[model samples]
Target: MRTIHTTSEEETCEAGKIIAAELRVGDVVLIDGPLGAGKTAFVRGLAEGLGADPRNVSSPTFTILQQYRGSMPLYHADLYRLAPAEVADLGLEETGLDGILAVEWPDRWTARPTVAYLVVIDDQGGDDRRIRIRR
Candidate 1:
């Protein structure tokens, strides 16, 4: 595990870019953070690093999931509004079958990937965020 303190949005996004550089196809990343945390910004950076257009990445909170193509494919999912019982209906695990699945509010899901990367972001009361990454 590695922990990083990001003082601003740019730093938070950079952290995501760093992670993206190391990602592989079929990777599942569990992301947990509160509202207004930089999860979406992080995903934007990740999209850029993976050779996709960062401007197109957004929180899939309402839509549930969004897909983008780059060096590989990226499947971003938001579980913030879903309950564990509803997760299976979405078949989210299959997101890893063809792309990198970055799931926000992953705790709402009952099952986890056998192997997964994780990123936890905590807002530190201001422009700062505590970001932890683990595999």
Candidate 2:
């Protein structure tokens, strides 16, 4: 497990970029955090580190899933609005088979990957955040 403290959104994103170096194709990252916890910022860094344009990354809360072209591929999903039963219909397992999958509000995902990186973000008031990552 690894823990990082960030006092700004940029720092949180940098942490994500640092962790991105350790990821590979077919990797699943489950991200859990409260509202406005900089989850999207972290994922923006992930996209940038994986060779994608960070400007193109955004929260998929309404769209559900967003795909980006990178060195491999980035399939970002936001399961906030879905019930656990609805998650399977998205075919996330298949979508993640060829790229790195990052899922926000992953508690709704019932078919979680057997092996995955779990990222938890805790808001510490103001712009401070504590991010914990583990496999």
Each candidate structure's TM-score, on Cα atoms with residue i matched to residue i, is 0.94, 0.96
Query: What is the C-alpha lDDT profile of model 1 across 1-135, one tens digit per residue?
Result: 999999998898899899999998889988889998998988988888898998888876468988888989988888888889998789886666876898888888888685898899999988989999999
In model 2, the Cα lDDT at residue 27 comes to: 95
Tell me the deviation in Å of residue 15 in model 2. 0.8
The alpha-carbon lDDT assigned to residue 79 of candidate 1 equals 84
Which one wins on lDDT? 2
Off by over 4 Å in 1: none
Residue 93 accuracy (lDDT) in model 2 = 80
**For residues 21-108, could you state the per-residue lDDT of candidate 2 as single tens digits?**
9998899999999988988899998998899999988876479999989888998998988999899899898987788999999899
Candidate 1 achieves a global lDDT of: 0.87
